[model samples]
Target: MTQGHHLRGIMLASVACMLWGISGVAASSLFAMNPDVSPLWLTQVRMIIAGIILLIMAQGVGAQPLQLWQNKYTATRIVSYALLGMVPVQLCYFEAVKYGNAPVATIIQFLGPFIISLYYLVFKRTKPTRSEAIGMVVAFVGTLLIVTHGHLNSLAISPAVLIWGLLSAVGVATNTLIPRPLLTKFGSLSVTGWGLLVAGVCLNVVKPLWQVHLTLDWAQISMLGIIIIFGTVIPFQMFAHSLGYILPTEASLLDAFEPLAATVFSVLFLSVQLTGFDLFGGALIIFAVMILSLDAQTLAVLLHRRHSRNTD
Candidate 1:
């Protein structure tokens, strides 16, 4: 890819993360306003609407839309991705924020990148470079600081909330890894479109969306529209498109913006607190992501240049 394209990919990924952060804040607000709305119901509306729109977009761009359900193996994989990755991601993260607050829930789900790194290290049998290792450590420490607020004895949230948050991280990793080959094959729009569609259908089976009634006012309807359009569809499409131009590692690193943005939005709109520890911890995580964005070769070259300058 050209330098400009690469830069554009990074920008796209960053904006996608920011939108996701905003979405979390919006979803949290919805939950607070409509305590009767079930997670499944909310997810169903968002997924089905966005999925339909994306499926149309996929076909408009000359992708094989039918292939998402034609070949049995491909269909199965798509279903698995929907059920295992997308469903868990949306449901768990939303439930996390519903149970706990948005900031803590978002910070906990930031473990997704580390989980991806460790998955490669253990399962793929790839040794992490020094930079990768150090970045992971720094990011992990930052998460701890954010979660525990420097006190080990007291966890800020309940165990169930923590479990849901970690589950969201798993969903994040699966969402990244499973769709990669699919993105290369069926295209991002097709895979995500089908995944959302299939997942929405499956979830509706469990909890019929018709049964969940919400007395939504105009403001609530507007918020739900933002959640569906700006939050679900656009950002997901942009993030998937960025993967075509950028590596998964870089894309994942860029996702550090999500939690930071979520924290800010939550504080501003949701009455969430941003304590000193949260700031310090969030900074460390962002710094760690920056480090991870630099490849081993680049870091090595920079070190070599620094050493030569020092010798002179």
Candidate 2:
């Protein structure tokens, strides 16, 4: 792609990450306002509503979403993607926020990018260069500072919240990686639409939405719309589509924006306090992202792609 297109893809991914950050704050607010709203139940609603809207949009763009069900193998993979990646990611994030707070949950989930890198190293035998290794260490230290706040003996939250937060990170990593081939094959919109639909249906079976009664005022209803549309649908579509243009590692690095957005929104809206250590930790994390962003190999790839496109 041209440099202009590359920049546009980065912008899209950045905006998507910011939206997800806002989503974390919004979901946390919903849980606080409506104590009766179960996380899984809310997730079910988000998946179904966003799924339908996204599927409709995909069709509007002339994408054949029905192709997802053309074969048993494809159908099964889509279902598994929903079950293993999308559903868990959303539910675990909401659960973490419901149990603890946004900043902690978001910071923990930020570990997903690094986890993706490590997974490649361990399983795929992709060795990290010196800069990437340093970046990983910086990210780990940043996470330690954010969670422990310079103390190791005590954590900032309960054990359950920590567990849920870690699960959210895993889900994020899985969500980013698993749908890649599907995105390449079916396009981003179709894969996301069908994945969300499958996840919604299965989650609804587990926790029927009809069983829960949510009394939403205008504000709550509006928040739900934002959650479903801007947060879930728009961001998912943007991130997925950007994956077609950018590397997965670049996508993960862009996700560094999410926690920063979450922290700002949480402090502003949820009245969460931001300490000096918090700022320091966040800077380290961003710096790690920059390390990868400025990597020689990554830059070479970008130049190569841009050159190839120009010649073509």
Candidate 3:
């Protein structure tokens, strides 16, 4: 890619991450306002709506959204991607936001790259270098500070929230790694549109949106609308498309921006009180991301394509 195009990709990914961070705060606020609303219900609603828009967008771009479904194997793969990837990613993150604050959830979700590294180490026999090892340790320590407040005996956040956030990180890893072929073949818009729509349909089978009646006022409706359109669809599209222009290493580094944006938004709008440890810990996590990004071994690992190196 040219310099200008590379910069555009970085900017797109950064803006997407920030929007996601702000969306985390919005989700936290929504859960607080509607105590009766389940995260599953919200996930279903957002995914379905966003999926429809994306499918329409895919068609608009002549990406052929429906082509994947015409073939049985591709259809099965997309469905698997939907259930295994998008569902956990969307539902777990929202559950984390619902149970804990946005800043904590977003920062905790940053553990995704470590999860990806471990996957390579265990399954693919890709041993991490010293820097990658150090980076993982740094990230773990930072997470410990935030969750435990530097006290081992007690957790600053609930165990349930922590579990959900960790699960979300796993979801992030799978979501990033599993859809590569789909992305290359059908394009990001098509793949995400189908994945999200299928996920929403399956979740709806479980939760059944019509079964739960929510009496949302205008403000709540507005926030929900913004979450569906700007947060869910737009950012997802931007980050996915940016992968075409820039290396995933640069994109992963920019992922740290999500937690920063979340922290700022939560403090300003949600009046979240962050301890000194929280700030220090969050910084450490971001630092680890940079370390992994800059480290040659880590960059080599990041550049390793899933099945075929030539595809990348």
Winning candidate number (TM-score): 3
lDDT of 3 by residue, 65-84 (tens): 98999977778888888988
Tens-place lDDT per residue, model 1, 1-312, is: 899899989999999999989988988898888888767788999989999999999899999788867777677778889999998888898889889878777877876756666776787566777877898889888878877889999985677778888899889878866665566668878999999998999998898888876799887888789889999889988887887788766886788889888988998888887788878887887787667667635433443454455335
Q: Write the per-residue lDDT of candidate 2 for residues 1-312, one digit (tens) a residue.
A: 888888888998999999999998988888888788778988999998898988999899899899889977668778878998998788998899899887778877777756666776787576777887998899889878877889999875677777898898889777866665566578878888888888989987776888877789888887787889889988987887786678766876787789889989898888988788878987887788668656736434533554455335
Tell me the lDDT of candidate 2.
Answer: 0.81
RMSD of each: 7.6, 4.9, 2.2
Order candidates by lDDT, high to low.
3, 1, 2
Q: On a 0 to 100 scale, what is the lDDT of residue 13 in model 2?
A: 95
TM-score of model number 1: 0.86
Candidate 1 Cα errors over 4 Å, as ranges: 1-7, 243-250, 296-312
For model 3 the local lDDT of residue 140 reads: 92
TM-score against native, each model: 0.86, 0.87, 0.93
Where model 3 places Cα greater than 4 Å from the true spot, the runs are 296-305, 309-312
